[model samples]
Target: METEPSAALMSAIVTEHFVLQSGAGTTVSEALGRSSLYLSALSSSLIALGFAAQTPGLLLPFAAAALPTVFVLGVFTMVRLVGTGVQNMLYLSGISRIRGYYRTLDPEAARYFARWGAGDGETDDALGSLAVRGGPMAGLFTAASMIAVINGVLAGVGLALLTYYVVTDHHLPAALAVGLVAMTAGLAMFFRYQHRCYLRVQR
Candidate 1:
């Protein structure tokens, strides 16, 4: 049987992990929001221009050709958003774990984590809120939710355009359905990617 680790070693490990968690959480969450904004802008521009590119007489073939490009770009953008989301989740998991250790060390400190107050009004804005209920982390997640919604809208538009093209040019109903599924997979991708992150934070 292996010997038990010393209390000092355990404490050192916890402190190191806590610092790592704080750094990663802050960095990745900001990166996720920034990237999401960039992709949202990119997709919006593409959508607007794709429609503008339509000619009065050549609408059908032009839009049909644009459908594939739109769908591919939409899927690619959404994949990056989902990947960034997963990294954010990892950061949240670290934060959750560190918060647990803090509470374990001193249950009374939980109140301070929610709000640090030394009777100074300045501390109100300076201290970060650790309350999982509608705190800064909540805002991070809300941003993610909004990003996902925008991505879903883009995917839906892609599906409609692709479906129109498939019906007009391919003459196949089954192909249209498959195209819908493939184009609208953004939400599916988000849920699948974030599921593990949710579980990690929960634990």
Candidate 2:
């Protein structure tokens, strides 16, 4: 017989899904910010390089670019390290909290909660077991971070070339600027849409 889930079952499923999605959203937002910063730094360095290369100095141009590049990469690495670390801990802690919550309810109700809670627990367990037997969250966050990194690299290179041309009194390149603007707008729209989807699911 086809049976409807109990109220407790519904609650458990919703809670688990909410937690996972919230975590994912946070991860995506963070990656977006980091990617934007990385790209901006790279763009600045390229602009500085173009300007410094015009001077009669020996080390200025290279130093200008190298210093910023080093700073960007360093920041990127540190952010990834910290963010992934927190995500890992949060995943485990959230699951633990969920399991504990289910422990106190009536047995029949608790059974439904237990089933969904098990799903929640398994989500964390699978991630935790990925590497170091506790690094799935870390790895997932790292992978997500790379998506932004890759986008930043492309955006940075494009903006740098555009800036170089602009400062040199060359006709401002319309195409690159247009492309960057389009990409930024698209990312914003995508995030907004995803957030709306999250809300609809929650409601």
Candidate 3:
């Protein structure tokens, strides 16, 4: 006859997995949030400086450099956010896999997460009965919220400034073309990454 694992051993394993998964999820969530906030603040500050730089005379000389600096910072910040989001997806991937194990151990765990959510409803009602299942990410996270919209605005401003700077400094229309191409490529890659992440959860 085949022998099954003892209840005590299974309990210990489940408890340990729960603790580890919880801690990992919290750490990733906090890091991702903080990173996003920092990037947003930095982008806003740069945009502010860009405006200040437009002032005639006085600090204009120093401020003239701010555009390039701000543009570069925004680019780097976007890259970092994209990378951190991938990290978030990885964390989610691992945590969800563990959740699968737990659900198998105790089928009751499955009900804790909602599979579908109502699009229009009172906040309380949605959260209580029909809110999206996953936190922050919400499985794919493809839908744009207010924050995502703001981030896109910031990125748009940065790209516009950067392309303008390239044209002005280099006097080359080709450089502007390149920047546009790069932005499009980056966006395509981002969507691909998100799509793959969403697919992982499906399985």
Best by lDDT: 1
Cα lDDT listed for each candidate:
0.53, 0.51, 0.49
Taking all chains together, each candidate's TM-score versus the true structure is 0.49, 0.39, 0.49
RMSD of each: 8.8, 12.5, 7.8
Which predicted model would earn the best TM-score? 1
Error of 3 at 116 (Å): 9.0
lDDT for 97 (candidate 2)? 55
Candidate 2 TM-score, C-alpha based? 0.39
Give candidate 3's TM-score: 0.49
Off by over 4 Å in 2: 1-9, 58-73, 80-82, 85-203
Query: Would you give me the overall lDDT of model 2?
Result: 0.51
- Writing each residue's lDDT as its tens digit, candidate 1 over 39-139 gives 66656666766676675645556545654565455455545554554455455445444555555555596775443323222222122233334223443
For candidate 3, give the lDDT of residue 172: 48
Clashing pairs in 2: none
Q: Between candidates 1 and 2, which one is better according to TM-score?
A: 1
Error of 1 at 48 (Å): 5.3
Model 3 deviation from the true structure expressed as Cα RMSD, one decimal place: 7.8
